[model samples]
Target: MNTQFVVGESSSSSPHLSCDVFLSFRGEDTRKTFTGHLYTQLCQVGVHTFIDDEELRKGDVISIELDKAIEQSRVSIVVLSKNYAFSSWCLDELVKILDCKQMLKQIVLPIFYDVDPSQVRKQTGSFGEALVKHKERSFGAERVEKWKAALTEAANLSGWHLRNVADGHESKFIKSIIKQVLQEVNQTPLDVAHYPIGLDSPIEDILLLMQSGCEHEVRMVGICGVGGIGKTTLAKAIYNRIFLQFGGCCCFLSDIRSKVEELGLVKLQEKLLHHILKTKDFEVDSVAEGVNLIKARLGSKKVLIVLDDVDHRSQLESLTRERSWFGSGSVIIITTRDEHLLYGLTTSEIYRAKLLNDNEAQQLFSCHAFSYFSPPQEYVELTQDIIKYSGGLPLALVTLGSHLQVRSVKEWRYEFKKLKAIPHGDIQKILKISFDGLDVNTQSVFLDIACAFHGCYEAEVIETLNACGFYSESAISTLVQRNLLQRDWPSLVMHHLVQEMGREIVRMESQDPGKRSRLFNPQEAIDVLQGHKGSENVQALVVERRALKGVKLTTKAFQKMINLRVLKIDNLYISGDVELLSKELRWLSWEGCPLKCIPSNFPVEKLVVLNMRESNIQEVGLDFQCCRSLKVLNLSDCKRLRSTPNFRGSRSLETLYLDNCSSLKKIHPSIGNLDSLITLSFSCCKKITDLPSSICQLKSLEFLDISSCSSLQTLPVDFGDMQSLRSLFA
Candidate 1:
């Protein structure tokens, strides 16, 4: 007896002699002979076998040791005899086996054992009779229910089950099951491909560009538009188009706002290097060094690179240099909201991406809201109203439409009314509705970019966050996985509207202007900087009544934040003695501050705008030499400003307003250097001017308002160069 036990134990435990065949049978029904024949055949093939012993176990309970033995076995051979469900322990074992299968992703092979699967599922025939008997027994309904559920679950799983078969062919079925399992173990799963959002006709253009080859210097295509108008979508569409055509290509979807807030650009550069080189390990310690390395490695390869959702021109300069940095045939695609961002790059290479037309918007909306090609009869009116509110913006349309999908017409109408009634502060209110559905961490990151930082460095944010004792890279990664935060070229950026909306939330929460003054606590600062926390307070550090005086900054100081939507440091000083006018800020407003000039090499590319509307500045120098991304330069009422600077390289300058510069005389001759200039208003600049012939070179110029330029008389005869001039208010 001891020797028999030893043999059984050795068969079950030995690695080489492990159970090659496990018999799964109801003890009272077929364990006596049917399993015996199967075991004999398996043993003949030098396979170890495990057969449950009914006598070894206590009454009504399955032995714990037996359960473990069954779980560890390589394969289970279930005997579905007529009386299978009669044994309660058998039902328990079957449920455990199915649980293991699901948890471990194990292979399961079922045998019909002279009974059909249909009977097992429907609990008909002998199986039904056994369940009925149990229900009628002293055992309660709950116990019977458990057994029924187990049987139903096991029967539902996809596996091999036999019916109307004999012991003679049992070996053949077992061998076939083993062979199939082995084959499955050897095969690898395929990697999932990313789907490009908003792909359409633009794909054709990208394909054509690829087919044309490197004959001409590789062209850089710029897709410029307002936030959420599908700039990133169009670029993604283009990327997907060429990804298959080219042997080497990389799409860097970095958001400048989020990167500066989280990891900084250094980590982003490292990721870019690793992805481009196809290496698992790489180091990019700084932005300058990373830029150099990227240029060196990518300079020779005829590759396709895409930088999506850019907010700053500095981001463009930092990532893709002159087309010369790449091979002759390489292609670079950049997407941004600010048209001024395309200035430093070639004008001929830029493409102003427009929002989707009514038909397209409606179709996109219908896809999300109705789940059909068109709106349903009941919700048609409400859908149209919702579409109108979206203003042909794809992101807004898709988001709002998705929320309304499958909802009742009443719900749709109510939502539409609420959206229409709400005042438009920033795009964040609309975005927050979507963001609120995300996990807490994602919401925190979204608000961080909207409130405290933009164009952030990923690594710096991470490092600063580590100091604050908030380590949740996984949570930040999860946000990226969900597409809430995106990588925009070398840095990270939030959607323009998203940032705007986030700031709005921060402002709303900080109802008291005084509370806004002390919001940036160190912990809160790190959260705001690294995109891990939302601002609960606001602190506008005003410099001076005439010039900003030193104001206490929150412990979380701005070190590497690159993108800021609204920076109103009115009359605030950096130190008690030094002036703080030289800081690189976007949307800077020193209304009454005593300041002279902006800092040189101040990363002007990052400013999608500059608003110094009401400032007391006498010497207004035109040293905007590096502010390539300055789309709108508002020097509205600077009465002391006398002469504009030579903006030769501000090629992306779309709108230049020198309104009310009463003392200003001669306009910069290089003002005509703007090829992409759409709106040039020298309104109220009473100083004399015989406009230069170079102004005629603005073939794409539109809305040229020389209104109130009393000193100006005859128009340039070469005005024929303003072919695209739609409204000339002279």
Candidate 2:
């Protein structure tokens, strides 16, 4: 029996449905014969059905209890027997059922028993006679018209015609009706989320993918994103929306990551088989056996499966390894943080879940905190602050909103202040799961990014990190695949809270700043530096002048931080004796240096990036003669009197920027021997300049810019011989 059905907007939108089916029929006609047998079968199949078996006398209107039953039922089965319209109670019940069909979008299936569908729809024959008798008995003309309309609407619906099948056999007809009713009732919607904000667009997108020309083939779709970004929620919503279309052979294996740990793979495989096959009779002793059973039994049955929170590729291998294991038109959905786990799926089938936008985040937060779509007027700014802190991550918003609920504005202010200092623990716990899954080296790379290099370009960061003995390129790809890091073109982006969590992890390593791997707080770095509490464990530190007023640092501050790989300080005054700094330092950004040159004793040969955009340096000379590893040297806007350094030893330099260095003059002749130079820019130098005849010998230079160099004149005779140059701005 074909029992596939669709619920209208009203039905799907109604969250108050209490019963599966409501029977509307006349007690005098086929109630005991046809309707009673159908109700018995529905109960046998575990369908929650409502039948009016009471002996109450017929009246002009249905009882209030009956009224509620019709409104609460998800599907109302109306038995239009020969005498169904003869009773006023049956007509009243039919009228109420039809009302629910329009208002609540309830499923109303009318079974035409022992009567012509046209006769019932047109109010002819027994249906017409019953209506005429009701009018003659003064059942109210307006009420009679409502009954007529209800009968016509119900009869016109697509439902069972008893006489058209099984040659009018009552037993066969009742069995078919039960089967259809059971199928309709078994399609229960899964609970997706409490708020379910920003899910419609993703669900729509996935649905379109499923419907895009591959309907006849089994398709595997992957929903991948970082933890707490609503991948599982989206998968559940999509499952709820389309599971019924695959009949009852659908199973949502939730928390597959944890469930696999708690109950072995065999249990999960059993769940798949039991849910689809609809019986617990099947038993498998091992995963291999379960796989065989799943393939042998379900190969011909179309199914819909959602594997939520799948982390390991092995979990997928043991569950939905191949598409041909199920019947054609089947759809398998997998939600994971690691996009790489979905190996066999095509790009079109993999959906990377993104964080919510401002509007969506606000609505979701407001829903949880205020129990409304928006916050109150007095809390709008506070709400926006929370949303901004959430970084559009739905989990953060939900957690923050829920924590702030029922608190006063003053309490919210205090909580926000604390939150700025530290991420909420609930949010951290979930975000950390992705980080915790990474290998140690990848974890180190992620911590570096979160602690210091979040907004830095990927290429620049990679060069520095790679110089520090990290497998940067591969680790970055791993982090990106796991959704912990976002590759925003050249720059890498991380969620604000994830960065906070990483920083917090470093902080939690020890109470003393000297012991932490990274220090971003100015006061903490000052304490560690001035107190002689520095340690080799501190790998990165930043001290912005804006955060610390009139802070002075001695070169001795770096005496103990031998492992420091990244150092970024802005406008710090240093006037004490110089000490040897970290030999491992690779990236150094001192925006406003107060020195004539890098401290003479400082070790910088390992430095990959030396950015001194605006500094007091007098000249670029022999201080960097041994810095063969330098890849990028940014000395822009260094207005002090200067000349280009002799590039005898900085052959590894790939980019040299001298933009706005008005005092800069002369290109050192040795620059021709710097075979690895890829970019050289001196835009706006406005100083005495002439091309070195040997400049054209930079065979590896791909980009050369001399725009706005007022004093610059003449190109090399062999400038066109710089075949590797792709862009030249003169």
Candidate 3:
């Protein structure tokens, strides 16, 4: 059943009208063919119809009763035929029908029966020749113009097109027409979100951007946002609000991203033309031909087109390439997850679909979960927890909220625990598509952040990962654009759910603690370390701040871990004759090393970053070894340090942080040759410092920090020789 007939059995929802349908057609044209069958179907279905079949004789005037019937009818069905306009009586009747439509605000449906609507609209073919005859008969030029205007107006309406739809089967066409009739008569509302929240602002913003100084100019607007952010809903709302008011063709092409594969681009193009032109079965065998056809046909008509869920720029290239493709006052709206997809589109602004705020999220979730605007007192706290995890994403909120509706509060608590452990499948499935779209290297970077580096500095993560042999420098921007990562002024931020999704992916690698690629949880790390059950597959690991008491690791604990690339274990308790770290290790951050110095056997050629911030272990190597690839080395707060390392082999070093190494220090004159260094920090090194004249030779250095050096210092006379310097902190 059509949604329109959801009320009383197939009747008009309005009770103020007298007759159900008023049929206006020519007796010789469609009285026995199309109109006759239509009337039979209407009457058989209990539709009270008032059709004036009384033919006036030659040169006889039409009775006033015919005019009365047109006035009393709720709907006027105008059937346009080849010879229908040849009769003066039919033209007079059409004029009266249109007048009643304006005065009574009646519903009007037009059926093009065996006649070209274009011929009727532009007064061109048989209809035009007949109108010329009417003029020759001196029916008055003004009266003839009125008849032509009425035909144009009626043909433009959304109604049946027989030649395009029903070439041979009239019965099938009649059924479709009746379905449309019922749909038109229906007063039922459309299907949309029950509680649409946080949409008014975006709608208002987009509409403002889409506005032109003149209504006669074609305008295009793009809505860019991530998945599950309600772009489609916003587009639908905007379409519903302005579609009918345009008095032209309106089309909303939805699910363009997922549907293109099945329906093909050519079919979508055909549908676009058919819906706007009020035709059916319009065929397009190729997208190229469809493009030409659309450009040729829709150029003169004002149209409202909303292309929803567009995932690629190619879709836009094929459908709406330019403003000139449509007539004046036309509007084209597109929605896509990638803002770059809308890159060169001719629009002033793009509206980004924002996540709901706290109150709105609560209310929306409540509607789906509790079937109302608020939750029960018992489940309020649990619902808040779920909302926090959802982070204002509409699809996640709705899905999780609805899933918890039938469960008890205790069950909600249990389900919340499960959601925290593993993300809701519905939410994760959609989010994973973004992850799955990336290449292997970018996916690795994303998982590294999710599992180990969520709160770390963005630069540090990028520099460290790039050192660890994962290309993260450009991938970060891609993740940010995809909405998986957000920039928080100085640091990077990942949604908690997205982070969990990455963690869950890592967990799926293996159920055993030692078999995973990375381990972040304290228990998992502890189990793997204490049991000496490490594996080569565990490439990265972080056992952060707190610990289960007394867990220890021997130096040989990492012997089996040949593939480890990153290790950041802070304040961990471990002591042993540590001889070897895997040769693959690139960045090592051990805050509290129980050993006196870094293991001599640790590979230096591959080591890119080494951080021992706030650690015990005074002396660095007397001479920096073959660490040719080292870009960053942070030993901030190494209180036992007495001297800087030799700069013999540290030429590639870019950033060297020695902040808060409060013990006495003496500079190595060899440090002056480090021309590749960009950032060199010596803040809070309270010990004495002397001049190294060669330091002035570092022309490539960009950042130099020497704050809080409480002891005396002498400046090199030629320090000003460094020309590439951007910032010098003294």
Q: Evaluated with lDDT, which candidate comes out highest? A: 2
Cα displacement (Å) at residue 92, model 2: 18
Tens-digit lDDT string for candidate 3 (587-663): 77787766566655556677777887887876676235578778788888888877777788667888888888888
TM-score of 1: 0.36
- Write the number of the candidate with greater lDDT, choosing between 2 and 3: 2
lDDT of each: 0.58, 0.83, 0.77
- Displacement of residue 87 (Cα, Å) in model 3 is 24
Global lDDT of model 1: 0.58
Q: Clashing residue pairs, candidate 3?
A: 618-640
User: 1 or 3, which is superior by TM-score?
Assistant: 3
Count clashing residue pairs in model 2. Answer: 1
- Please state every model's RMSD to the true fold in angstroms: 21.6, 6.9, 8.3
- What TM-score fits each model? 0.36, 0.82, 0.76
Error of 2 at 579 (Å): 3.9
Clashing pairs in 2: 11-105
Q: Candidate 2 residues 291-342, lDDT tens each?
A: 8888898899989999999889888888888888989888899999998898
For model 1, the superposed segments whose C-alpha errors exceed 4 Å read 1-199, 205-216, 423-730
